[model samples]
Target: MRVLLVDDEHELVCALAERLGFRGVRADYAVSAEQALELARTTAYDIAVLDVKMPGMGGLELHQRLRELQPDLPAVFLTGHGSELDFAAGAARGEAYLVKPVGIEVLLETFARIAGPWDGQGGRQP
Candidate 1:
């Protein structure tokens, strides 16, 4: 599925994007909320993986803004903080949450669960 990966860490974003690519998942990386918003406006991404703690616009805020643009698309929060409050917020928004340093396999599984079955016919068509 097409995924928008939003994270401030350049290395993490690049690594994740590359790993996703290797798995045949189409992933676009955005370093900031504004860039993600801009990308969302023009592209139809199936899911957004956002970092909960960002410099300017946090993941929750970004999630809200993304909903305004693409309400149907699902968003998953990739956070380092494992707090009840963060989990609650993600749950309330009908979104998934994953901790940092996640294994690529787990990340793929989480994306599959959140984005639904991939037809395997082509690249992240779903």
Candidate 2:
């Protein structure tokens, strides 16, 4: 599956990208909302992993914009703050959210749950 990961934390994004790559997931990353938006426009991704608190656009706004571009795209929000407001907003948007420091197992499980199977390939159906 193709994934676009957006986060301000450069180290975290790199680490997560490496981990996802090792697991056979194609992941491209962006550190800012503008870059994420640009990437979204140019690429077809099955899932978008977005950090809730970003410099400019933030995850919620980014999610909304992304949906405008590709309504069916699934998004997962990751937040270090774990604020109730963020959680509520994410829930309202039908996005699956995870707090920072989330384990690989949890990440994988969440992705699998939201990313439905396409035949026997294990990727999302087009």
Candidate 3:
């Protein structure tokens, strides 16, 4: 499915997006929350992969705003810190989370679990 990835680290996010692409998952990434929001407005993303701690707006706030745009959109949080509070918040919100350096398989599997029938088709559901 089409995915939106947001993180403050440019290289990391770009590499992850490319890696995901190699796995046949179309992933667009943003380095900031505003950019993510703009992309969200134009793209009908099936899932969002967001960093928990960003410079301006954190992933949690971004998630809420994205939900406003696409209510059914599923999200997965990625954090390098792996703080207890972050984990708790994610759990409380029912959002699946993964620590940084996550394998592409792990991310995709999480996506499959959250959004069933992930065929790597990038939302070819029409």
Candidate 4:
């Protein structure tokens, strides 16, 4: 499966992306919402893992914009802060929320649960 990971924490995001790649998942990462938007426009990712509390256009807003770009795009929100409000916002949106320091295996499982088996194609045919 192809995934997009966006988080301001550069090391964490890169590490996660690398780990996913090592496991045979095509993963791309961005450090900002704007960069994520640009990648979203170009790539039809199977799923997106976004930082719930970003600096500017937080994950919730970014999620909406991504859906606008590609309707039905599945999103899993990641947050290290784990604020109650953040949890509520993500839950209210019908999106999956995962606390940070999450394991790679758990992430893969989440992706499978939401987006189904990879199909080995990486993305939906446009």
Tens-digit per-residue lDDT, 1-126, candidate 3: 788999999999999899888766889999999999999999889899999899989998899999999998888988888789889987666458889889888988887788765555555433
TM-score of 1: 0.90
Q: What Cα-based lDDT does every candidate model obtain?
A: 0.86, 0.84, 0.86, 0.85
TM-score pick, better of 2 and 3: 3
Clashing pairs in 3: none
lDDT of 1 by residue, 1-126 (tens): 788999999899988988888777888999999999999999988889999999999998998899899988788888898899988987677467888888888877887787776754325544
**Candidate 4 wrongly placed segments (more than 4 Å):** 119-126
Clashing pairs in 4: none
State the number of backbone clashes in model 4.
0
Model 2 Cα shift for residue 5 (angstroms):
0.4
Q: How accurate locally is residue 121 in candidate 3, as Cα lDDT from 0 to 100?
A: 53
Ten-residue stretch with the least lDDT total in model 1: 117-126
TM-score to true structure, per model: 0.90, 0.89, 0.91, 0.89
User: Which has the higher lDDT value, candidate number 2 or candidate number 4?
Assistant: 4
